[model samples]
Target: RYWPRFPRPKTVLTVKEVPTVDAAFVLQSVAGLAAKAALRGGNRDMVWYPIGHPAYLRWHEEMLRQTRANEQVLPDVWAVVEHFRRAGIVKGYVLFRKDAGDRRLHQRGAYDPSANVATVLAARLGAVMVSEDIEHEARARGLQRLADARGLTEEQCYEHWAAQCSDSVLALVDPRVPHCRAEAIALDAFVLATHGPLLERALARIRPDSPILGWGAGDEFQLTEPVSRWALWQSATNWCLNLPVLSTEQVGSTFPASSIRARQRSLWDLTWEDGVHYTSFLMTDGDNVQWLMGDFQFGAQRSWWNSPVRGKFPMGWGACLADLAQLCPYALRNLIRTASPRDDRVLMGGGYYYPDLFGKSRNSLEPLRLHARRIRGYLRLTGTSLLHMNAAKWDSPEAIRAYTVFAEEIPELQAILMVQYAPYTAGKGRVLWVRRRDGTELPVISARFAIWAHSPFPDDGPPAEIAAKLNAEPRLAEPATSDAENRSQPAEVPGFSWVTVHCWSWFKNAPDDAAAGAEETDQATAAASGAKRGLEPVAWCVRRLDPHVRVVTPTELALLMNLRLRPEQTLRRAVAELHLRLRTAQPARRSAARGFLDKAREALVKRNYRQAFLAGKNAARVLGVMP
Candidate 1:
């Protein structure tokens, strides 16, 4: 009935259709969409959602009341009713006796159990009763199951027990023809499912054994294996091998280990030789790339041999392509190139009702709009830079994955994700690679590696620590005879205070500042006409955070360039690079003062109205010309 105007909206985009029966739910659904869209700046120019807000609830309720009574309802009223049914606004449903001749519906004047007057005239009223037909459908299917399970007893069983309790159970019969699982679950109505995906999700929410009456899987499924558990990698995959087709065990690659190992070792040699050169060589490995490309698009997996005539796994198909793209590199694009619809696999096998997780296709490789969180155990680990290998075979893809899982699955290294990836091979089968993927590089795996250290403000001289008087343990409450909580001392170390350092807090080099100062100097030179103001911009060092800003104090500026931890600036990891850079250059202040004074001296000597301007700035100080 409505739409969100957004994303430049070159073409109208839609989220299928809204549940039309439940009007209450429609509001929540719309609000939910708006809340998420509000977080991003992308749709600012477009309308987020529609009009007709729920703030005016009374008008809607009256409209619903008028709709039930009216023989001919307006489209707006009908639409609202349908939205309510879909969104699940009705709190209760028809729960009538099933013994009646017709169970399809209640009489038009059926008693409203909810009315204050129903019980008041209970004995006097002879109103008809009706129930939503969800359980009734289940009884029909359950009879079918009983027939298959016991044989020769299906019809008789229904004839005896089902009829004897037909009124008791028929009222609970399955499938409300007017509505379905969406309405049932949304309304939290207890109803039976006939072996479907809705049943899976519903059973997951309301405990699987919550007296959930459903037709047993008579024809839908059967398995010889009873229970499953992972023998390795997972405790369940081992038993899952009992699946009709392939399982994780069957999902592994058959690429020869020796060949893969040789390729990896060759890459390792390249890293040892020259990183840039190796990169250049791999880019030209046309033969190796072409072989991988053909295999990528043409494998036994492409044919229906090992492949499924019908497939499953919501993330598997896209995962396969993403994996191939990563493992074989550019071959993914080539694999798609020279490929046809006939080359793809057909998808099938249950979970079709799960429109979101499985999408609306049996065998579609639609782009998955998914956000997969790679907890360290799950990420592909590559020792890119500063990565120290711990007794594991370096550059072995399998070994890296194993170690990453071990680090994450094991107790001690929990919450940590170790990544491994196939490194780029370069220059005649050699590898030049970063030792370990640094924190900056960790983003490739969509992760952040935060390190913790125990230090007592080495640069701050412990003055700040004494002033705060904090400790790891929370402060103890003073005794009744002692001071009150107000005067109680805080812990010696406060809670875990995490400080992130980006780089070395060094001043910008004088040359860089001079380059920046070029324009201003040009302007000043222009103002001076043709005279040599000798106003050359001096070189000075500054840290990234406004590093070129003038520094007035020696002590404040000294700690910045020493590579030593600065009192205020947070920079530790890159201190090594910063130290090398700063130790090689003069102090920023010294160079700055010299340049300013030199220009002033030249101006004053030339009588360029600068003798007064030379008040305190000395050119000697700037140029390092003492005395």
Candidate 2:
């Protein structure tokens, strides 16, 4: 699935005055318009670059100067009227108006209706949709071209398009409905109802078994702007790939890709030693490409990526490589090009389509295999092996078994950096092994701690606090001990501990911090108005750690854990322990354990050790042997 030669834009059009209501709508429509024009021109013609974000603008300028020096540059570009006009693609405009009584509806989940309607119309009619507030601005900025070319008034042109779309516009979800009391539930229902059919229709147009893009559903709280921006990118991506966009929600039950592929190559060559607490830090939430293209690209995250201390330590960036390859190949290539060797590694973020919500049934392994294939394909393309995955239910053995498929299918996939958000979950700070057919083990290491706004661990707190917490964790402090009562067996070979530091929150400058030094403080303030936070906090935490702890890249951490752990013996012992527990377990627990045990034995017979371990582990959980 790697592009031998990525598509490059012949011209770059900069959209200024961004993040405003009017510009948001224009930004939403321009990419699709450019895409339609590209179809006529037989090449990727232009890149619709949005400005007004100082950090992003600076990054964009640097990237362009570095990558596409010879490409034509057009500054202060707007409306994209000429592209659409030349292509004769814009039939008319779909006018969306905010409710008079609820002017702020667009900011809330209610705006999803208009957003979905615009996406459907953009795909079907080559139509441009804009909010009523931007109608005048759009016209004066060249949207009037359609009306002038047709010798029709703007009102008449709008009416003509409106008549064609009478059945296309979706009605807003009524929050007053009895079952829609909660905002989250209402938003889910709204997306399912409004965007569901449109997405289904689009999917039907593509081959069922072909790989489709999983562009996530936009942010629900602020639906209007984000969805509008996504709609533009979605349209362009749809045209470029000739494939439909599936939300993580939509693909949870049944992912439809026939196979996923990436280039396979060695990323790094490193050796590991024992008697050290090996820690790897991973930056999280890169599964969402929209976030990558929006905030992560042009927002405060730019500063984080550009931090002077970035390459000084081993940091893993969780990135959606498949999406980047399709939407922003240049940025993806540049990111890999600029990465520090042996220190910075771009791990596959969320496994192609972010399988947190994927079904855990034995049958789901088919989709899981396809998903891993996609991740493996991209890993080969990017020359990396570690996969960082988020699980909705990481505590269950069935979930772990599903994940084992990645290690089973892709030998290149050395380890999985697993994270779960559920409260009181017991999987953290432990390493689960999947024994390969050749008797080798692949390690699945759970996050020891996380830096996230909503996480229980230190989020915005001082680095010293997190350092203290890490030093106190029993798993990191000493070798594992046998737990006979709980059936938690000791590591067959000990002396090494793996700690993964997961970060979901961006760094922000603290104004009161005298420790940042005057020069660093001034730089932060100037770069992003004090909104940006660099990797200094991570560096600080590592520096404050106990002397025995050694920071390593995720790749090295996996290698060390694999070398020390005895996968076959550990899994066999776990299964035997679960059988013993079943004797005294309650009837309900015994019944569940019996079923999972049967599956485990079956998988073992087939030499599917990964699945067997997961099934056995699940059985143990049922009998209260494993957490």
Candidate 3:
């Protein structure tokens, strides 16, 4: 059963401008309007005319013309009608027109299932359908003959009849009418069914060039999948791209999938939502945890490591540390070293785009100050007091500037230390410098034993091959030059004949644990040969290569570079620092701390740099600072 009730506006307000209609906005407006309308008249009836109806086409054209003429009328009239229908305030009916050509066309429905579902929901909410009267249709035909006599074609005459019929019925609608709860539910259903395609279309149209403009995405122009035929057209002419932005034409491949990066992205979102309370956990692939300690991943890792934590004991605050196999002692040391700052705050991990540091001009110092404040906030939340600022990517000038700013802004903060990307490659574990915008320069000292994060020794050939490679390269010696010359001139990284034997991370067809163990054995053998020839190890091997091979913590290495100390002197200095920290320590721990310091001094006297470093490192751990 169907009924109709029309409430004509007392005065029709003319629309001055016509803007492009957005379905999402229309849905929201309908929600707001329905709530109001339902409150105004509890049992009021309204009519919902489908946008696909021939009546709507006429109204659309007229609306456009009127808007251009500056004559006011209801804009998005179809949206208003649909909302009223779904709101259960309207009677749903097809108005009859005598001259309307091909009556079957009017009965044809919307192609989208979601659109059909919407109508069903509206009908259930108290809408009724009705057809036109036959007697009234006969009178309409008499007027159609006049339209035909006025030089109108058959189709034009029929359209005019249909348009007039729709106008007579719809003109009764008040633009401000709203709906009820039933209508709101119907809109939600429609949105759920249609959101997928809408979101994808929105993502596709986004301009990848500028991130600022990307924030304002989600334009309403739309088309869906399962097309009978498709083509890209310009002015009714088809065109094809010789080169596509993506190599694959598959749409599925273009959309991002779940991965480590996706996890990191979600964590970032969580951080923004409630950074104070949320603790994020990241499970990443690749065994390059050592590389993670390097400069490459610093910016990304900062968001996690520096995120604010909550609770009285720092239990619920900050992120958790995890890895595939058991984490290495050196890796843990590095993690602690990287996380530590003077007041025990979080690290900024440098700015968003660190490489552009030198090129971009900063008018104010607020950005740097903000990052520093974030660091301080993290420290305060975590209940910790100090973080060791070691393991840095010293290559970027901007990163150096950020570090310099941190030192300047924070009162209790000490100067930031930096390490080389790969010490074995070039720059010879020397101290580097960066020039600030004000022409002031800052020192960035390198860590000793520029240990290979991944295996540096090659396995393709014999163990002697490692020595042959290092022997071919220039020796690792400090450059005897002025600070100005060092800053102005770029040093070329000496070429080594050795091959990159072990890639730390996993691959699709990577070897299993057993095979990996054997590979490590071969790499260690090669490393030992290189050590015999004065080639230093950047990182620790799974097994010790030689008793005399020196190993030092990143901080100790940096200290050595700054002081220009030889291996024995560096070891002795580390031993002295440990003793100094334990001088005023409690009696309970004094004995244990003093024992390690004494052992370190004895090893230094024995001229065994490797043993001395280990003893010194242990003493530093006992005293609670690696410096």
Candidate 4:
């Protein structure tokens, strides 16, 4: 036997001292750096060690063959065998009976059961199977392969795992590791940033079973989420106290009740004023397109609280909150038609006028991002995407600047700057520059004209008149010009030339007589104009406008603006360059357009102007423009 000399006398050394072992090899095989660090940190559950890759089938076959034949093995091969034997990797799999449980176990390897078992046991033992350098790429590949095989997308896989497994589950990325312990690390960061510990704890202390204080029409109201029926069955229930139980006829005759008692106190005591606040909470359920066109009606009040003679609905967040509860599901589903991590397309957009006035500042980037995230989650769950325009509350230059910064920071969201009212527009919506006190101007992202009409209220003129005015009068403002841009411009610009009008009266509660009056108006308009029954006045009027006057949504408006506006003749220059490239292209490069060019040349030579124009038009169309 080979023996190594020790520092002390050999006679004094035991038989164990005769064999030489490298300290580095022993430290690596027995107690790795990651393992030693874990031990030092007192976290025994984290027992991961970077050992080796899954060995090829041939490597194991040769090793087993050598062992069975009683042939000598290399030192490195002997070390691997000795390490696995000592670690009980082979024994652990046999004890667990993994192969017997899963038919797909053999897919990973064609080697003997023990060889495959070693790799499986190492994985089960929390070993780091691959180097950290390729971890991200490896996770991506794993997700892709699973998605390809199962016919699911990578996002779907992540969502499924998040719902069924853990919110922090990285299973789509790291199948070999099973589940990661650091899954909720990103969520924790978000929670800390948004809802701090103090607020979280304060909200947590409120008993869920306590009676919820809510105000709205009871029987007439339609909750947005369908699970409201289940919510009533739970202990933390919401009771809408003001049900307009009286019929429209009885609403007038009944005396106003004095006060109500609930949870050991009069409801009047909680109020600052002796008179109760009148709030409007309307819910419209139907096709959102019809709703957008002002076809939907507000729910019947049939109660004294919202009696048109005694009180008017408050126009603020209290009213908006009620409406939001009803329209949330619809807005979340229909408003945002598409979403993407990188898509800059403007599919749709709309502005909320009162979000910041009530407190939740949509003018800031964080709130917008948070709102986007909420919609993003909903869209991803349903496998959809969309774009929206969230406007600031105030219509001042300061508000515009704040919102512009928000939009600039998050261009992917494609936010369009807006304000509730501006002196220049006087609340009649207009996309004009507001000059600040400091003489700086801010560009508002709405159309130059807006028609705000409340139905049954009569502030906005009849739909026919408004529609005719819009078609005949509204036009996009002339493009901003610099000295260098002296080229000719179109005399009449075409497309959506005004902000989408607000027909809020379409959501007003009305008396039976008033409802009949509206019906009469509808019938009269239909008879005179031959418009379709049940169409909103606005929709009817728009249909009557000149066919060339387009009715575009806010998102479509943004797309058109970006498309038509040339920043210092950027679009013009690009088009010119494309034409130049076409004209000067080599024969082989222009071969695709050679036939059109030849036809146009022949027609010009023959003095056939019409034929020449036709061929030229075709060639221009092919070049992505018209002559």
Best by TM-score: 2
Query: Which segments of candidate 2 are over 4 A away from where they belong?
Result: 1-20, 40-47, 52-79, 99-109, 134-274, 290-303, 350-356, 359-363, 423-426, 437-439, 452-462, 473-534, 567-627
Q: What total of clashing residue pairs does each candidate reach?
A: 74, 7, 24, 6
Q: Model 1 — TM-score against the truth?
A: 0.17
Candidate 1, residues 1-627, lDDT tens digits: the string is 000111211111112233332322222222222222322332211111122322112222322232222222223322322333343332122222222233233122122221111111111121111122332532332211111111212223233333222111111112212111221221122332133343333233331101121122222121100100000000001100001000101102322222211000101011011111000000011112212333222333222112232122110111122222222322333333333322221110100011122221212212111111111211222101111111112235433332333332322110111111111110111121112222211101100111111222221111112111111112212212222232133222111111111111111113233432222223233433431111010111112113112211111111121111111111222222223333344688545654554554455456542231332124333333232
The order of the candidates by TM-score, greatest first, is: 2, 4, 3, 1
lDDT, model 4, position 388: 26
Off by over 4 Å in 4: 1-365, 368-393, 412-429, 432-443, 447-459, 474-496, 499-535, 565-627
How many clashing pairs in candidate 2? 7
Instruction: State the lDDT at 358 in candidate 3.
Output: 20
Model 3 root-mean-square deviation: 23.4
lDDT of 3 by residue, 299-372 (tens): 32222232222111111111111220111112222344344221122221221112113222333345445545
Could you give candidate 4's per-residue lDDT for residues 11-118 as a string of tens digits?
Answer: 110011112122111212122212222223422211111212221122223222322322222244223323333443211111111122232311232212221121
Model 4 per-residue lDDT at 278: 12
Question: Candidate 3: where are CA atoms >4 Å away?
Answer: 1-352, 355-362, 376-400, 410-429, 433-443, 446-548, 562-627
lDDT of 2 by residue, 1-627 (tens): 321122344555544445554444444455445543453455454444354454345445544553352444343334454554565755555555433344242232332234433433444444565566667766675564231212222233333343333221122232111111111111111111223334333322222112322232333322222222121112112112111111111111122121222222221123333345666777665565545544554454544566667788777677776666544444455566566654445554432322433432222456556556665766775667787765555646765675667767787667777776443123545667775555667777776655433234422234444455455433432555454232223432343333333333334434333343222224324444543343666776677677666777777666555533553444454466667877898999899999998897787678676677668767766776534
TM-score of each: 0.17, 0.61, 0.27, 0.31
Best by lDDT: 2
Candidate 1 deviant stretches above 4 angstroms? 1-404, 408-470, 473-627
lDDT on C-alpha atoms for all candidate structures:
0.20, 0.46, 0.28, 0.26
TM-score for candidate 4: 0.31
